[model samples]
Target: VKEICSYMGVSSDTVYRWVETHEMPVHRMGRLFKFKISEIDAWVKAGGANRKPQKGNSQ
Candidate 1:
């Protein structure tokens, strides 16, 4: 989470929110969240991170 936050310039909370609401591709190792740079790049290129949450949803 720390690495990704640095890479993306976003907070850990934002990453967690994206994972929950935007289907950001991530691997779960028990309680740990794992990410691949390639997958993250692809997701970003595909506009995954630019998506807004649905109406009535709160971050």
Candidate 2:
């Protein structure tokens, strides 16, 4: 998780929120979350990480 967070340059909370909202690609193994560098790279390339402003966001 830390590695993924570092690679994505985001905090763990953001990652968790993305996973919960089905916005990020990840795998679950029991209580563990798994990720592949290739898949994440592909997702980003496809604009998965291009976050749009939420409806109520102040920013």
Candidate 3:
């Protein structure tokens, strides 16, 4: 859990809140939170916000 939090750059509390608030899907294994890497990656992709163009990419 801590590792995933670090990878996502979010606190554990935030992750819990996200789960509680239905921000993302969560998997449970015998009362333990088990998040799959693929799910998280998919969630991040699905939750992507519009990005602005950078000057460097404008060329």
lDDT of each: 0.88, 0.83, 0.68
List candidate 1 segments past 4 Å from native: 54-59
- Pairing residues by index, what is the TM-score of model 2? 0.80
User: Each model's TM-score?
Assistant: 0.84, 0.80, 0.68
For candidate 3, report its TM-score.
0.68
Q: Candidate 1: deviation at residue 16, Å?
A: 0.6
Name every residue pair that clashes in candidate 1: none
Q: In candidate 1, what are the lDDT values of residues 1-59, reduced to their tens digit?
A: 99999999999999999887746889989999999999999999998888887765544
Please give the RMSD to the true structure for each candidate, in Å: 2.8, 4.9, 11.1
**Candidate with better lDDT, 2 vs 3:** 2
Candidate 2: give its CA RMSD in angstroms. Answer: 4.9
* Residues 1-59 of candidate 3: C-alpha lDDT, one tens digit per residue: 68779879889987776666555567878878888888888878976212222344321
Give candidate 2's whole-model lDDT.
0.83
